[model samples]
Target chain A: MADPGPDDALFVNEVRGGDQKAFEAFYRRHEAVVYRTALALVRDEMTAEEVVTDTFLRAHAARERLDPARSPVPWLQRIAVNLSLNHLRRRRLGIEALPEVAAWPDEAATVPEAAAERRETTAALARGIERLPAQMRAVVVLRFVHDASLAEIAETLECPVGTVKSRLHNALRLLRDDLRRDFETAQPGTQPLAAPDLGEMGESIG
Target chain B: MTGWPDLARFILGRRAGGDPADECAIHRPRLAELVDERALGGTQADDAATTAALDHLWACAECQHEIADLLLVVAGLQRLGGTVNRLEPPPGGWRRLSRRLAAPRPRGALRLRVAGLVVVPILAALLVAPALVRDLGTSAAGAVDAATRDAATVAVPVAVTHAAALQRAFDIGDGAQADPAAQAVEVVPRGPLPDGIEPDGSAFLPGVAVPPMPAVIPQ
Candidate 1:
């Protein structure tokens, strides 16, 4: 909640100077966001944790190349995203495997009700997001979770703004349709409906 | 009046601004009136041109509905964003990074230790091998010398036995004179026999006729 102070800046500067304390501070500051982003992409917590750790380790190794004047958050995010994507690619090739979770909602239920709701919502969103094609899911996660701007997303994805826009449009439409269908299904007495057809939406966009 | 869909597109495009002349010239003021009813509330001024375009929105319905739909979409998106939790880094994230950065680098010491482990023994082996070999060689030579001396001691008695057999075949006793009747005799004349000895006389016979000594001693 507090604004990052001179100490934070000093710490980052020290990290650039190869200071371990500063590097640890940076890791502690960004691990959750990195892990969450990785988890969203890889769909595995252990892999996500590895991605988070690797991201920080790389940042530490490359600190000398880092521009101290810029905030390290986005840079760190980029590293985590790339790592997560690489992990996915390797998984697809069968060189790596996804991790299994022992429990989920039950474990989350032990938290306070509000926290539980948030967790459930996050889990649902994550499932919906996973159903999307890879490129589209990446755009959605980067845009929504990281709150990255269109330009930032484009830069991260290494694509044009037009591509990012189209991906976002398609992804959001799919997500909306999926959420709607899921909502109807969960409600008792409501008949389960077919997934909303996005062909009309796509035609409208064009 | 402009058609509903075209009017709607024009209104949405105009509201977003960056509309070229071709796009803008077709806008009908009445369409704007229709669209305003739906999308007018959160039409924040996007740019100066967009603000100026609002004058058209004030009068067109089709344009109003179009803008309203766009606004609704935006609002929905914002709600969706709100529903999602704001992602924060894990606790102690930065602290962990700082600890890592502050920790001493171990690679240098490890490399040195490994090098010492690998190289020191090799150097010791190289320095110590020659001495070890020399010591081994000296021990081997001493053993050979001892064996040779033992062999010589053993051979002396065997050689005496062989000499005794040769003496018996010649029928020569330890203290015997040469036979007087032998055809040839070899006298080394090792310092004239004992005092007062004749050429043919034995120690027991002062005047004995031994065979005539050969003119030249047989070899």
Candidate 2:
């Protein structure tokens, strides 16, 4: 809670030496962020927890490879995100459905009406995101949710910053248009407009 | 002068918490005011700003509403971050792993004890049985050889007695030839004789003739 301090580096170094207490210290320090990041991607508490566990377990196994001189938090977070995405991708294939937005802990969605609206909006957002091409969704998610800088996103996605910006622009436009169409259709007494297909949307955005 | 669209783009591009250039800095507060007035439409109810500069968003109604909407989207995206399940370590997870690592190995002495239980008798039999059997067989064979030697020594007298009796019956006198007297004495008749006559002719005849005998002994 006191921001892990410089002690985290010492603990991580000890963890590399197979120190259980050091490993426990590391787990306690970063579990919340790791869990939150994983939960966002996978939308399931169990899967997110698994991702956190796996990320830590892997970090523990490869502790020697971790730079003891650096902050391990970001490195650990990166592992959790990558693992969570892979899990979501596999789950998506198994269900043959779009990835669902992860639900928050029971306490986060307190009011029933508010919860229901969040769920509906989340579902719509997931479908809209799923409809986007994979690269565009990555840029959008990184830019919007993670608040990653263009360079950081580009680095994460292994693409040029120009490409990241272009994709972000196109993805945001598509999302705005999709949400607008959905909003209109959900309103009373309005004739539903034909939603533009993904290719047409991409072309229009381009 | 830059158009409103260019100004909006430049304002949107401005990094939060970063220092902007002098020309952009002059327009920054006015740009924030315009954004507060026009950009979010009429969705936000209050337009009052607490600070003279653009930093009072936490209390401003218009700013709060816009920020809330962005935060809502951010919150929704944040929900999409990774979901975590709270796992307490499997009960005794560490204890179990520790127990496995700390368990004592079977000592060499214990292994030898087990080997003794399994192998000592087999090894003893291997060492002792062959020697015992060889000793028994050697003693039995020696006894057999002694009995055979005794039998050979006793057989010589019996064989000599048999030879002497054979010589006396033939009346052989220290030679291999048969005795002439013994040859001349006919032990059996050469021809058919009467049934009541004794072939030796010591003469107890019973009314039947004896056959004539030849006097010369055949050469």
Off by over 4 Å in 1: A1-9, A102-124, A180-206, B1-219
On the 0 to 100 scale, the lDDT of residue A94 in model 1 is 89
lDDT of 1 by residue, B56-172 (tens): 554545444444433333333333333332433345445554466567765566456555654675566545544432332123422323333233223323222223223322443
Question: Compared with the true structure, what per-residue lDDT tens digits does model 2 show for residues A171-190?
Answer: 64565466546656798566
Per-prediction DockQ, in order? 0.08, 0.04
Candidate that scores best on lDDT: 1
User: How far is each candidate from the true structure, as Cα RMSD in Å?
Assistant: 31.4, 37.0
How large a fraction of the reference contact set does each model reproduce?
A: 0.12, 0.06
Clashes of 1: 44
